[model samples]
Target: MANKPSPSPTWDEYVSELGRNLQRARISSGLSQEQVAYRSHLSRYTYQKLESGIARPGAPANPTLRTLVTVARILAVEVSQILPAAAPDLPEP
Candidate 1:
């Protein structure tokens, strides 16, 4: 029999966990969302959206690498620390 492919993860799940990671990192760094946004050169509103893991009212977030890098830098965390473990559906390089 041909091998079956597994269901891919909903990116929302990964994004939600990433948001939690960012929140925890920010809390640990003792910075408010506004502070991190300012330091990262992002608008407070944008940062809030990032932290909520939502791009819009009902859409899942898909942040830029630049945004992730700056936020991680401000939080004193490696980007890996904030990223979820898997992207099984992602295309192999």
Candidate 2:
């Protein structure tokens, strides 16, 4: 049988988790959102949305890799540190 794709969290779940991770990292680093935003060269509103996982109209923030990288650098963490762990390749039968 062909290999099936791995199960993963829903988009909302993933985005929410990412936001939580970012928030935790920021707090642990003793940096406020505004400070991180300034250091990352991103608008405060954009960084808020990213950390909250909600865009205008109640949609997920869905930040780009570049944004994540920039924020990670400002927070002094590797990108993987903010990413969710890999899901299992397949669900059990």
Candidate 3:
């Protein structure tokens, strides 16, 4: 039999978790979306979309790695802190 791919969360789920993590980190850092966005050299709307995980028509935004790095720097957090943790692998018997 062919090897099967591991199951993972849907794209929407990953986006939502990333957004939530960014929001929490921003809140903890006592910064508003506008403040962070400006500092990160991004538009407020873009940052808002990233943090809300809704770009258009209820779809998730596709954020770039550069954007994430910028946001993390502005928020004084590591990039890893803004990303969601991966699910642990299952153990074999």
Candidate 4:
């Protein structure tokens, strides 16, 4: 028997979802990207890019985990809620 591959989301869908998550957090906290950037020690442009889904790899490119933690703190939410979960690999039969 052969294992079937699961369909993954399209690139655009992935980008849009990430962007939506960022915007939702920002809006829920009544904060602008600029405010989050300042508090997180990230540039406004970088934060904006993240919110716009212009940042490549469909995720924020913050080098350090501390940077994401800072942003999560500013949003008053768990980092896991914002970051994408890892997809399980297809089984090899």
Question: TM-score of every model?
Answer: 0.84, 0.81, 0.81, 0.66
TM-score of 4: 0.66
Q: Which candidate model has the greater lDDT, 3 or 4?
A: 3
Please give the CA lDDT of all the candidate structures.
Answer: 0.88, 0.86, 0.86, 0.71
- Write model 3 residue lDDT over 1-93, tens digit each, in one string: 998876776667778888999999999999999999899998999898898887887787779999999899988999999887864333566
* Candidate 1 lowest-lDDT run of ten: 84-93
Q: Candidate 3 versus the native: TM-score? A: 0.81
Q: Which model is ahead, 1 or 4, in terms of lDDT?
A: 1
Clashes of 4: 0
RMSD of each: 3.9, 6.3, 7.2, 5.6
Which tens-of-lDDT digit does each residue in 3-90 have in candidate 2? Answer: 9977787677788888899999999999999999999999999999988888876687778899999899989999999987753234
Residue range 1-93, candidate 4, lDDT tens digits: 899865665545554566678789999999988899999888998888767766665453333467667778899998777765533233467
Q: How should the candidates be ordered by TM-score, best one leading?
A: 1, 2, 3, 4
By TM-score, who's the top model here?
1
Error of 4 at 51 (Å): 0.7
Candidate 4 least-lDDT 10 residues = 83-92
Error in Å for residue 76 of model 4: 0.5
**Model 4 residue 7 lDDT score:** 65
What is the model-wide C-alpha lDDT for candidate 1?
Answer: 0.88
